[model samples]
Target: MKNGAFGRDLLVKALYGSFKKLNPLDLWHNPVMFSVELGAIVLTVEFVLEALGYKKGVLWFTGWTTFWLWLTVLLSNFAESLSEIRGKARAESLKSYKTAVMAKKLREPLPDSPYDTVSSTDLRKGDLVLVEEGDIIPGDGEIVEGAALVNEAAVTGESAPVIREAGSDRNAVIGGTKVVAGRIVVKITANPGETFLDKMIGMIETAKRRKTPNERALEVLLVSLTAIFLVVVLNFRVLSEYLVRTTGRGEPASITILMALFVCLAPTTIAALLPAIGIAGMDRLFRRNVVALSGRAIEAAGDVNVLLLDKTGTITLGNRMASEFIPVGNHTFEECVHTAMIASIADETPEGKSIMELAKKTLGVRSDALPKNVKVIPFTPETKMSGVEVDGHSYRKGAFSAVKEYILRIGGTLPPELERVVGRIAMSGATPLVVVKDKEVVGVVALKDVLKEGIKARLAKLRNMGIKSIMITGDNPLTASAIAKEAGVDDFVAEAKPEDKLNLVRDLQKQGYIVAMTGDGTNDAPALAQADVAVAMNAGTQAAREAANLIDLDSDPSKLLDIVEVGKSMLITRGALTTFSIANDIAKYFVIVPSAVSPIFPHLDKLNILRLEDPYVAVLSAVIFNALIIPALTPLALKGAFYRAVAPDKLFVYNLLIYGVGGVIAPFVAIKLIYHLIEFFVG
Candidate 1:
């Protein structure tokens, strides 16, 4: 109940659901609980027989045993029901944001095309919708034309507006977010009920959630233990009859007592809370604004040994800004800044925008209006440069080699200090973009991309936990090495392409490494699919989201660290509770086994370390204790166990002393105290 707290209505619904789960058909999935229910029914019949004067034991004893047995099953049901109710409540809240809105449906993919106004719910895949400023996006889609500043607080919970533009990796947009500035034509990618929000809501609902691989395997172990314990308890009746004949003392174990012993010996504590633990793990991730398509992804995160991260937007601030304008030869700083700003007038990349901002702030230069006969050259992979031609002069800024070749071809000599200046910038982890006007070398703009704060510290923690961190980037070797050293990553791949990432993941997997890849682009889909744990950004392309199992709504690639912690916490909680549950039987055995046989073999009473005076009270007390512990530990199951970064060997020893030893001692004290209270009341 951290983010999705239970309200009065949710609590009432959960209470009702607990009773509804009492149906045998519903309990059938959990074999241990189902067997407990069967035992409760048998005890109820035995209590009625005692009341009708067929008396095999005291009527009050039989009645109390039956009541406790039923309560045990009910508490188990309530734990699971409460977890499911919280999940549904979160789903309802997500649904509230997806209200109907009118969309301007475009007949053609043109800015001024004929359009029809239709409800957002009627939107279909591949439909083009024209959205303007102040209009809410009708559905999840990619911007096909133009760009806008969108407020996506409805889904991401971040109030800052993000820029979504056509022909860029950041073009994807979710429905229910308003277009706060500019206009865009969006091409719908999902049908009305198949949007990202719809998929998230469906995945969180209890009925639709599939059991994770770990959950299924644990359930099998619990069922097998239940079967093994059932055989041991059933054999107790034969042993009791033999003892009665040999000593001519005591009665054969009654059905009520046999049922009580069987329930206590079985691993009921872990089984009762297993489903709740799995549901709570999903709820925790949802609270962090991450939606996991399957529980297996989260479980895999706990075991990941290698993390592959994209360099830009993940490790670094991503937007390279002009930090310095170093002039070459006799050119002044103002001349270099003016040339760079003029060359980037028709550019729209983040680096270009930053250059214009730097120029304006430094020298108050403005290029708001271009001359009527101006011609622009856009940057492309082949050209590696962008520039504009006006008044019979060409201004350009790009990679040093590209700009050098342009000036050389135009019959100009290179500046004497240009090479040294560029090398200094590259060595300092900044990209040096050469600026040239006509046939003369102007200067270089040092576009520096800074590392995200605390990234080095986070990677160091991952290293301590035995997870290797690798950075992948399209930058040259010099820049890549500088950033890798600055971020403290274990390894790096320079000048990497889409297939390079895919091949790296496959190679790491072949070496028996569990790789976790975080990416947010259409080019990242192949690698995301190949990695063991794939986390895609929600703002990424549809292909990336579809390929990855985990989607980060806030689009922060560093969130993978939090995901790993949550996964480890869930696994640790389940393992600790299981250790405690099995250890608990030690105390129950001392309370019930010795008391059951002590009537015929009085020497066996020495095993009753708590020194209970009444056999009937001892058995009843153990049954009540077993029932009460389910609700007592419900909060721990939902909240998860305490976790820290420690060696596996040390962790095992620590848990053994805490939960394992504590579990053995807690029941002895509780059962003895309960027996005394019951005896005083009966007397």
Candidate 2:
């Protein structure tokens, strides 16, 4: 409702010369409907009395009618104030969308979405583009050229720069990722509308739509409880009328007065409490840098026991560096580096650039020559490798799987020892690149991204907190498990596609586990949306930024623990206020009922229950008490107050005791004081 109303307001503000005369108050949001509803109810009651031949004096009816009208107006104003706060908070939660536009300063190229690349302005689908060290990726794609350390925390919830090298099966680049080191060429597989970043942001924007069972149940309870209270109050009025008719006395002035008080105190006071508390809780979260897209997510975050995570950027260092150079073709490491450099001179992949950088570092050689008269076949998903021809000699380099297929097509097989060596490297989470020259396998280079600092210790901390951390990835099982064990992950899923990641979250939710998936790239969008909580990286892809609820402004995986703490604290705070408000109301009923009915407390009944005779005094007292006493006694609502006399779990019981037990004593004391005051005045 908040979003819809805000959206309507936005439309109105944007459209000129339409509904220009209509004030915001003229809309259904004003207090007018509440006043009309209350007035109609009062009139209906008067009509019912007249039909039963029990017409009251004009002053009695007029006073009672006027009181209800004002009561409804007051309640409506309170409701609207809360609603406005919520609307503003909801609008602010989406401030990141504006940031996306600011990201345009990076002048990132658009991926092939609108379908024209020459203009660079018209980024068509399936175009391979390059992102330099200082440039941002314009679209989401697989890294095809150059190895780079990319900060993707904005796109993925995890605050980490992921390293991408060629031939790393899990490597995927997202749009808006800042190239921290090296350069990369990305093959744009998804168009702008279909990009991962867009989907993630869309998910975040829609976060408020989902609701948990508890919140729904609470809503039902509020409605039903308010109705029950109203019925009881009405029944008491009927009983008073019955007593008056049986005694053959004039209708009791006090009964009508009590009815007016009940009307003002019952629905206005109690029903107002529920939504006010909820909106206040939301505002508190907003102030705490927590963007709660939905009440369900906020509630779910408090209940999450096991938080499943993705490994690539979540638990381990996401960047892989070129670490080893092994030569097998009667060639020294220098010779191999030279040959590889020549082969990759015209290449633009991250792994190629990493290899080139290694050659420069090791041999201190620099050359900017692309072999003349060269024919190149760019790597495609089907081929899984790329090849270049220079002076009628063809050289190929790519994944072991692709190389093996090429060898078989030519009726050749690798030596058993060589295959075993590659297998061992692959098992250790390394990408094996088999270099082939003149259709004969020459050597292989194995590379892996190093792990992040203190990841194992962090995983241990998660375990200590009783959180079962699971790693999900698209890597082969051997590679996935190797990284998982090294990172101290409790469980893992390998070779999972994007949709599979999302489905896995759903499955975990069905089993009653709260899941959180972190990805700084476009591919992580769906899974981020699927989870109960979506954490996006401050440096991650546009899709991820759009999809998540919470952004790791620092792009660090460790931030999850901090967010969990914040969410837990927020729930505790909400529980605190809920207990206090309900308890106070319950106590009021006990004290006010006994005090008003006691024969010895005639003065208690004579005193204006709501001080309606003087509207300013009554309203001021109610407002001040609501703003000060109730809020102050609401132990949880107290500013910066933590763990006082009561633990979080015991708060509800404490509040009930104060309101129930203390309430009985409170009214008796008040009545006694009133009697004494009246006697002294008479004396």
Candidate 3:
């Protein structure tokens, strides 16, 4: 019932728009419809003159024929107007997500800073705003400081509350979402009317999505067919006039009959509905919680051959945590864990926090250290070590080799037991970090990042689709290989640098593969830019988001599977309809052509195989069918034709026989049936 109302509203708009767009200059852009509009006008003039007795019975059916021609043009416009209405209505509802809110603009992005109240619309890019619990986030931005539990049901259509923290990949937040818990300072990324939802609304409302290469080629073919029909209509008229002049026929063919024949011959049925088909595809993607920058990207999703997946944060749960603490030397387990907990006290990473929690749970250790006078060295990707100094003693924890070398440099002897312990933990596919106090090796902390549930099944799905999933990580070869096998990916690149990932995309492209990459780090930005289809997580850095064409709002890399299916459906839908549309013209030709020319040459009546109706009725039936067919198939155009995951050659041949051959036969029965019904009603 709701769809019915929306359809009615669009028809009302098209009724008004039809008159507004009736001008010759405006109609010129649509050459196929412009021809029909011209024919309608010329025949209407002739019908008016004949009705005034200027000529007797010269255009007996011209008035009704002209009416049908005008209606035909209006139906085509109505199909487009109705297609846009679906997304337009959704856009209006999305505006509700942009609810009015007062933003507290910070003088600087920090707590306890001066702030001023302002409307969300007044917020500008790079401006910082403080959001408290239960307040709507003013605009699209990154959390510059603090953390919050955000309700994102309006955007991602999930009811779960997501944690957004500062200085992490998941820091970005959308406007109009509420901070259900905690507080955060956000630095706006987009101004008002420039948020992600706003961009999606604009793309859907405009409906001028960029066309893929195949769609462009199909358009050229349709236009060429229209041009050929234009010539056919003109020559048919010339022959009618020449025969009348030489043979002194009873009367020249009615201008209305010629107009009807032209409308039936052209492939205007598909042309009128093509834009609607593409718009429906985009709306489908948006409904699935994925935002595509353009229609071309969605089309590319259907053709992904090689999928390059990141290991951390993509295939596994990104929060790497400390699972077990093992004593390395002759030190007691509790003593080593107590010291490890103290060294990781100021650590903000998940690994650090989990270690503190574990120590408290097992040894009942209390955190009572002083906050001042502590020298700290943070971990860097290059150094791979972190340490703190209390008084004059240094406590450190890092990779086993880094700690072992530091202790050796301080004149400490190596322990044989430490090497065996490290090897056991490494073989288990967990990160082993050595905890040290001054020059003594104390213990090893096992950090494990668990793989997400059902990831192996997701990888298997991609493999069935002929997509090769390759895992790339900076982890050691053994760890990478173990994770690769566990995840069931086809290949793995161990200890791979950002440059290696970028080079892989280039090599894949050289081998004629459509390589698609998914990443969230700033280091992945360049490779994402070079990929055929780049999908950036919604929680990724701004650089990664800017570089990617598709943004996965759910942040599940496996969403790629759904995207590919939607894309294949879009392409298949268009192909199947185009086949049916052109083939439909063949049946209409047999219905109207013989009747059109039989009046000019009596012998041509034999070509009318069915011989079921008068020439006037047959022409009227065909014209009415042309106008009615647009609405008859409007649902199919918007919803798409039936699709299956079969090879293109198989799909083409299957559709050719079904839609192509069937389209030619079905319409003949319908047109004749319609004429017989009209004849009975008039009687």
Candidate 4:
């Protein structure tokens, strides 16, 4: 839909939601508004009776009062409906990228038969599909063959084209992203209507934003306060009669007095604005290009004590590449470089590809002369090594510890000189991929990955929020420490395997900490599930995405800091509004109760500190002012109260001074002005 049409639809739907709010049963979701709404209903009946000239005089005018009461309820509903309207417009935009198209499916691997053309929806999981340079990826899949530069702008909102190749970590591809160069054979990972983008769109359309724990707890407190006010109003008759006997004044029991007192003292403002606050928070997250599986997860992030970050793909650029070739143990640099190339000949990692290129440039090794039918050992998180075997001669290169153990297993130990060289390289903060041939150490390939720029400042923000950050890596301790110190993380864990990552999360939780893990590797799946707040990359594997509660579409790990702020924004917004709501009641009681009953008592007129022109106008003005404030604060509720990172007590003190004092002062002035306006017009 166009912008104008979307806005028009929003107002219409808001009107409909307002009508639905009139039902008393619907008040269960908004109990604080229930008493005022029911009062408006009763006043509307009196309006009809007074108009018919039945059993009443012009003692009270009910028309404008009734109109103000109901308008308050409708304004609250409209604020919430408008928030969802934004989400609907975004969902429609996502749908445009998924228009139907024909996909070329491969039935056989051999180049013997023509490919079959099938509907995009007909492509099932595990089916192989061929996408040309300009074609959109048929489904969410893993690249199993060929390479391509794919544009992920539709899904991630990034315009840069990323290279995708078979048999590597960056192979995952999303449907609806365009292929910009080369062709790729993708093995579908998701079936029809089950793609990642589909789940994202479904989330927005439903937008079932559940109440955060803080929201729920505050609601219970508000309900209790409402009940207490109800009891106080009920017994005010008995309390007033005692005074009536002594003073010879005070009016008899009246329903209008009870209704006005209940509406004024009860916490209605925040209650009416709670749903709007929550929906707006979700919409804000969506605008940041983050999709939260549940609003609860976003809230949980607010209290996260420990942030667990992966070192490779998250903290660094994640492009581990060969930077230098260092030979050890009396071998020429050329011999070591040639042996490193052989070990990485069949390896497909970016690290492996860089090793091959480095060898050709410096050592003049020819790729065409490399041996064929060689056995390739793929790197695994468990083994932490990759190797090649040609006729019983094993050439390996990987993590230093893994390669060291391999040399010992074959009765050939790493020479002291070679081991010292490995230590020197690792101490330099570069990953030392040790190269070995025939169980003897040959050289070390220094794989360098730079830390992301401006990461330290982001980590500092998390620290101010009372969150401790730790970096976990499979690199040696010296390298991990070097990186951690430069990055300014709170702590670092070196040589961490997949299981070690899971154990760290479990231990932290056992000690009363909320953990948040960010990773893109399948190995991080278990750790992600174990953490309190699991964030996955959009370019990550499907398994990793399934394990995570939030997805960063930009694939930027630094977005976690922003997510923390968003979560805290929700809690702080609700808290400030709640404080303001209750505090405003203090002023309302002064205006409403004295104006309602002081005519008979005359002595109770002392409480009319504002010295209003007329008595009935004071009471009506307080009620109208209270009703009008709901819509007045709607913008603040939707935008969320201004938040700053501080300790809990300090945060409370700050909000208390600002909202509490302001709430009390604002209502008194507004009600007094409204009373003057009523005198000017109606008198």
For all candidates, what are the clash counts? 0, 44, 0, 0
So what's the TM-score on candidate 3?
0.78
Per-residue lDDT, model 1, residue 112, is 94
Task: Tell me the spans in candidate 4 whose CA falls farther than 4 Å from its real position.
Answer: 1-27, 57-60, 108-114, 237-250, 320-425, 431-449
Model 1, global lDDT:
0.89
TM-score for each of the candidates: 0.89, 0.51, 0.78, 0.81
lDDT of 4 by residue, 347-422 (tens): 8878899999988888766877788989988888887888899978888888888887778888987777876777
Q: How do the residues 1-683 of candidate 1 rate in per-residue lDDT, one tens digit apiece? A: 43436567777787899999999999998999999999999999899988988866778888999999999999999999998888888788888888999999999889899999999999999999999999999999999899999999888889999989998878899999999999999999999899988887787765355787888999999999999989988899998999999999998988888999999999999999998888888888888988988888888888888999888888998899889998898899899988888898888888999998888788864555535566898898887889999888898888999888878887999998899999999998899999989888899999998889999988988887778999999998999899999999999999999999999999999999999989888999999998889999988888898899999999999899889888888888898999889889888999999878889778899998898878889999999999999988988898888987776677778888889999999999899889988988888
RMSD of 4: 6.3
Q: Which regions in candidate 1 have their CA more than 4 angstroms from the true location?
A: 1-8, 321-397, 406-417, 435-445, 679-683
- List the lowest-lDDT window of 10 residues for candidate 1: 364-373
Q: Which residue segments of model 3 deviate by more than 4 Å?
A: 3-29, 55-60, 243-252, 311-468, 474-492, 599-607
Q: On a 0 to 1 TM-score scale, where does candidate 4 land against the true structure?
A: 0.81
Best by TM-score: 1
lDDT (CA) per prediction: 0.89, 0.56, 0.80, 0.82
Could you tell which candidate, 1 or 4, scores higher by TM-score? 1
Q: What tens digits encode model 2's per-residue C-alpha lDDT throughout 359-465?
A: 67777875644456778768789988776878877777778888888988987766555688688888988777777776666677676756778878767766665
Quick one: ranking by lDDT, best first? 1, 4, 3, 2
How much is 2 displaced in model 4, in angstroms?
A: 9.7
Tens digit of lDDT per residue, candidate 3, span 1-683? 43553456666765776676677886675667777788888878878888998966536467778888888878776766677676677777777797768999999757779999999999999999999999999899999899999998877878999999998878889898889999899999997888887887787677758887877887788779888887888888888888888877645666666778888888878877777677778777777778888778788877888888888866878777788989866888987887787778778888888888887888875666434577887987776788788878788899887877788888987677999988888887788888988888888888876788888887886776677889888989888887888889899898988799899999999999988888877788999999988888887778888899888888777677678777777777787777777888887887788887776687877768768558778878888888888888778877777866555677778888888897777678788888898789865
